[model samples]
Target: MTATPLIDPFQRTIDYLRVSVTDRCDFRCVYCMSENMTFLPKKELLTLEELDRMCSTFVGLGVKKLRITGGEPLVRRDIMTFFQRMSRHLDSGALRELTLTTNGSQLEKYADDLYAAGVRRINVSLDTLDDQKFADITRWGRLPQVMRGIDAAQKAGLRIKINAVALKGFNEDELFTMVDWCAERDMDLTFIEVMPMGDIGNENRLGQYWALSDLRDSLRERFTLTDLAERTGGPARYVRLEETGQKLGFITPLTHNFCESCNRVRLTCTGELYMCLGQEDMADLRKPLRDYPEDDRALENAIRAAIALKPKGHDFDYSRQKLDGQMPRHMSHTGG
Candidate 1:
């Protein structure tokens, strides 16, 4: 039987999938979520078996790249075992790349195990280099611990990328320092413009949103950034450093919308398929997956129906809407 390929309304081939294993995290970054919050119950989250089945279905559909994300993925119990189970697909050439996006708190403990389980690429979230600033932003996170995790990942031979959320009053001063830090280690760094997601006190965070265009201009003063013809399956735009030979990326969803080239979809921990991060269009996959666990045809049809309904682009105009509605915009909940 011939399988149907999953293409969206924009004719973009959907080959990338970001799955949120859990919405729980150790650090509550100011830009991501508020300190006080409610998380989904364990029963509500998709089990390992269910996640494996869903991943297999996506792989069969046409997904080549799979990224395991979380509020913090490492915090999920026996997540390495889950990765090991999925690694079989990578070993069998069923999937092209298996990657993880983590908070780096538990990377030191799981880096080696993760590599052994077929995860070769990792993106660690590190906003400020300053310890005090880190604590201030994350409320109770320790910079030293995250630093050790990054070091451990490098030692484990994993390709590391530092993901920094660009906030105006917070980490703006450290942008150049971050570039130099990545260059010294021969690592790639990506700066993402803070999006108005969820109820993380948008009023307080509104002043912190920094545009990527301005950030690029700032980089030009210190270093010459040569545009690199590279696509990473996600929204980031890659560039090469003329002097240090290092690579830098920008994910400017707010200032510069890259929705036209958006080739990925986010699956929340609770099994909701979010077509766009900025919009409220989502398909409930948990009910379908749970209702028809033995019916692969039913599961596949549900996913295909959702993918067919993916919009051309997100309606994210900050000037008009503040994203203050009851929609789930929390990055943790949406598998950022």
Candidate 2:
């Protein structure tokens, strides 16, 4: 009932799909967002059925992993109904694993139903441990709500990934504290080096982010840190506390760009296919899905054309430069 999965001229089998359901988000993270973002009109975004058709095509091609994201995926109106449709379309076995990344503002209420509908795991974006510092960074801080979402996810039988963006002067001191908080709950914590995304000329931008090596050294002074080989297409490299069973992951995108094994591709909320995070070029998917609904070949061909154009990687050096100058869309918008 499915066609072969799409593959590019390079012969890499395209399988993973990260879809942005909506550009609307509840929070404003400094580094990855731009306030001036004039959102796409509602009629332009892919409807549920249209999105399902694309997802089915990808699954037929060879996609085994599917992740739902957004500026905050939960911010999409009627999100629960969307999940139900996606769940019925793919089922648990059709897609190897289905997951989502949320800002945690609404997870407390919907976490259980989200899991019931087919999401196996949920990752929450949480920057700081201090309430005031959290507010200062997110502009509204809502740390309590974020924490409650974490608890809700744990209770819903979903594996938790607490994503922490390490800021140097803000709350970098609490990196291990954040780790311990998750360790106590048996959840994993990943510390990301705030990536330089979006327009750098924007005003409310980030200052400096902590480096991975430096964080390892600091954590070693207190807890015995050990390396683990587990990793994925994601930017984070894993480390664990020797005695506490606490794990830490470092995403050093700014210093060491991991582009060689870049096996994934992204789909924006409006249906454009972006090959890399740093590049501006993208292929239009919405046009074909609507215009050539009967032509599967055309849709697959367009995707291949985009894949052939995937750039090598990004150019970033935190020591001498900052990636904060010109931001791409917000991280939420890009499904980060």
Q: Number of the top candidate by lDDT?
A: 1
TM-score of each: 0.96, 0.91
Tens-digit lDDT track for model 1 on 126-196? 99899999999898799999999999999999999999998888888998889988888978999998777
Q: What is the lDDT of candidate 2?
A: 0.76
Candidate topping TM-score = 1
lDDT (C-alpha) at residue 136 in model 2: 69
Off by over 4 Å in 2: 1-11, 35-37, 89-92, 200-206, 322-327
lDDT of 2 by residue, 1-336 (tens): 445655655566667788898887777777656544567789988987777778766666677777889878887877787778677645646677678888899998899989888787777888887888878667644988988887888888989888887777777778767877888899888888777666634443345667877878888888987888986556678887887878788877776777666667889888898887777778998888889888776777777788888777766555665443344566666788
**Candidate 1 local lDDT, residue 48:** 86
